[model samples]
Target: MSYVLITGASSGLGKVFAQEYAALGANLILVARSEEKLLTLSAELRDKYNIDVRTLMQDLSLQESAEKVFAFCNREKLTVETLVNNAGFGLSGAFDSMPLEHLEKMIILHNLTLMKLTYLFLPDMKRRNRGSVLNVSSITAFQGIPYNAVYAATKAFILTFSESIREELRHYGIKVCSLCPGLTETAIFDKAGIDPYQTLMPIGPPEPVVRAAINGLEKNKNIIIPGLINKILIHGGRLLPRSLMLKLGIVLGRNKKAFLQNSC
Candidate 1:
């Protein structure tokens, strides 16, 4: 049976993706660093959906993690019909003040690992002439976010890469979509040290975001931006001057402490 392989399946959007796929009666291969969470989610999905759920615990920020995940799927005879590259983290602070190691890890997890996984899995999909890839980018991808520079840049790469591949793989009947959700109900805000309430933007739930992404992927959309407000923000931002957008990004991107400090 074919499986939908999802990275960072332990929590947030990744976890929701796993559940949504399982609900669609698809088998799943969930990869994440948290073994306990993965196992728990795997068990829950299998029991509720009566679909096979396999879990792999690996920190995707590591260099060789994608290769290892590919190898495991091969060894298990798991035919991945869909691959969701959703493993990522963000660090918010002045670029110079952030830890170098964390920044490097973020780059690896968001870009390198995602790219490697796509490269590893595309050959199989090509041979089969059928597959889908959902890359979880962010609304931040549309611009240069000041406090969240690296993360935004990584997401931008995903957006462009997904669009490029969508065109290239169309002949092979493979779908490539980039999911760019705005502020959603997820742990990313806390992890990135940004308080969602402080941002003054409406924080959406994961269900609708994942739903739109799956629907968009099914239709082979190049990009899926979830919320209506998010759509407005993205489209309207394009009409503004780059300098003005950059200034706005500084206010919107900063954490509570940074925003307060700047306000004073």
Candidate 2:
């Protein structure tokens, strides 16, 4: 049977994606670093949905992680019909002040690993002439944010890469979509050290975002921005002057308490 392979399936949007796919009666191959969470979710999904759920406790941030995941799927004879590259995190602070290791891992997880995984799986999809790749980007990809530079850049890459590959693989009947969600109520805010309440922007729930992603991928949309407000922001930002947009992003991206603390 074909499976939907989802990375970062331990929590947040990843967990939601797992549940959504399970509801569709699709078998799942969930990959994440947290073994306990993966096992628990696996059991829950299996019991509730009566679908096969395989869990792989592997961190995508490290080198050779994508290869290992591919190997695992091959060993288990899991045919991945859909690949969701949702394993990513954001780091907020002065780019210079952030730990180099953390920055490296973020880049690897967001760009290199995602790219490698796509490359590894595309051949199989091409052979079958049917598959989908949903890359989880962010609304920040549309513009450069001051403190969240690296994260935004990485997301931008995913968006552009997905668009490019979507066209390239169109003839093969493979769908490649980039999911760009804004300020969703996920653990990313806490992990990135940004308080969502302080941002003053509407924080959307995960369900709609995941729903939009799945729907968009089904329709072969090049990009899927979840919230209406998020869509407006991305589209409106394009009409503004580059300098003005940068200034606005700087103001919006700044963490209030951190800015005040740094000032003092």
Candidate 3:
């Protein structure tokens, strides 16, 4: 059977996606940095669904991890019918105070490594003429998010990149979708150093995001915004002038903004 490969499968939307796919009777290959969580999830899914569930514990923040994941897929003969590039985290507080190593890993995980994995697997999926790719971006991707400069920028790259390639893959019958969910209840907040309350406003759980993302993949929608309020916020931000948006973002993520600016 074809398999759904999900990075960041240890928790949040990634974990939800794994469960959703298994519910749909799809086999899975999960990847994450948390070996304990990954192993637990792998066993849980296998036991729950009686589907073949394999896992790889690798830090996607590392340069070689993408290559390793790709190689594993090839060796296992796992036809990656779906790819969920969902592994990422954010840092809050000030940019300057954050370790340079952490910043580098952020870029590597959010941008380069994700792009690398996509590029590696996409060609084979296209040649086979059947597959879906989901890049988990965020509503923060719309414009410059003050505190989340690099993370937003990386997501923006993912958003545009996925849309452009979605058009290209039309003929190949491969669908590429970018899921731009707003603030969800996840560990991303703790990682980013922002309080969950600091998130724009009230938001739904990651479950909707995962469900909508899966639906978007199946329908071949180029982009999926899981919540109506988030869709509104993203659109509203675009309608406003950049200066206003930036100012507002600073208020929302002051620690991040000041840190980045000071570091620069």
What local lDDT does model 3 show for residue 152?
77
* Whole-model alpha-carbon lDDT for candidate 3: 0.84
Positional deviation of residue 130's Cα in model 2 after best superposition, in angstroms: 0.3
lDDT of 3 by residue, 1-264 (tens): 689999999988899999999999899999998989988988888998899998998989998889999999999998898999999997755566778898889889988888899899988988898888999998777888665677778889889988898888889998899999877888877766677564445567888888888888889887899888777777778889997777667644554445355446
Worst 10-residue lDDT window, candidate 3: 251-260
User: RMSD in angstroms, all models?
Assistant: 1.5, 2.1, 3.3
The total of clashing pairs for model 1 equals 0
Residues forming the 10-long window of minimal summed lDDT in candidate 1: 255-264
lDDT of each: 0.90, 0.90, 0.84
Q: Judge candidate 2 against the unseen true structure and give its global Cα lDDT, from 0 to 1.
A: 0.90
Residue-level lDDT tens digits of model 2 in 1-264? 899999999999999999999999999999999999999999999999999999999989999999999999999999999999999987887789889999899999999999999999999999999999999998888888888888889998999999999999999999999999988888987877778788646787899999999999999988898888888888998999987787667545675565455446
Pairs with steric clashes in candidate 3 = 90-192, 91-192, 92-192, 95-259
Cα deviation in Å at residue 253, candidate 3?
Answer: 2.8
Assess every candidate by TM-score.
0.96, 0.96, 0.92
Candidate numbers sorted by TM-score from highest down: 1, 2, 3
- What clash pairs does model 2 have? none
Candidate 1 segments whose C-alpha is farther than 4 A from its true place: 255-264
